[model samples]
Target: MAVSFVQRRFMSNALQKWAYNLSGFNKLGLMRDDCLYENDDVKEALRRLPQTVVDERNYRLIRAVQLSIQKDILPKEQWTKLEEDVMYLQPFLKEVKKEREEREAWNKQY
Candidate 1:
């Protein structure tokens, strides 16, 4: 049972890695988080990010757009590796969602 579980876990991670690489966005030097759809929560989260982080995100996005327009990809070495793709906006998004939920609940109570 444990062996099967381990195998499943390994396969799951391998599949995810394969899918991540296949997505092609990383080839343009964009991170997984960078590809997220900018919904209201994401917009709010982005608004709450620090200026430096926002600048970096904008630079990456601009560069990606330029690369797409040129029909080019970054060098393989420059691709965003799975190990380096951290969820920088997740905490902010989570906080925003939580605050929104709290506000909604308060409104319901009033």
Candidate 2:
């Protein structure tokens, strides 16, 4: 059972990595998280981020845009690797989502 679980986990991660590479943004040095659309939750997450994180996010975006306009990708070494990519904004977004859910629950007085 443990062996099958390990294989399943490995296969799942392999498929995810393959899909991420096929998505093309990694070529531009953008992580999968960086490609997420800036909806209200994402904007809230950005607002909650530290100045350094915000700066880094902006720099990555600008760099990606510049690369896109130049019809170029980052060097192979600089490409975003699946294992190294972290969803920096996801925690804040999840917090915002939780707050919204709580507010909705409180509002349901009927």
Best by TM-score: 1
Q: Who wins the lDDT comparison?
A: 1
| Candidate-wise lDDT, in order | 0.93, 0.87
Each candidate structure's TM-score, on Cα atoms with residue i matched to residue i, is: 0.89, 0.86
* Candidate 1 wrongly placed segments (more than 4 Å): 1-6
Model 2 whole-model lDDT (C-alpha atoms)? 0.87
What alpha-carbon RMSD in Å does predicted model 1 have with respect to the real structure? 1.8
Worst lDDT run of 10 residues, candidate 1, spans 1-10
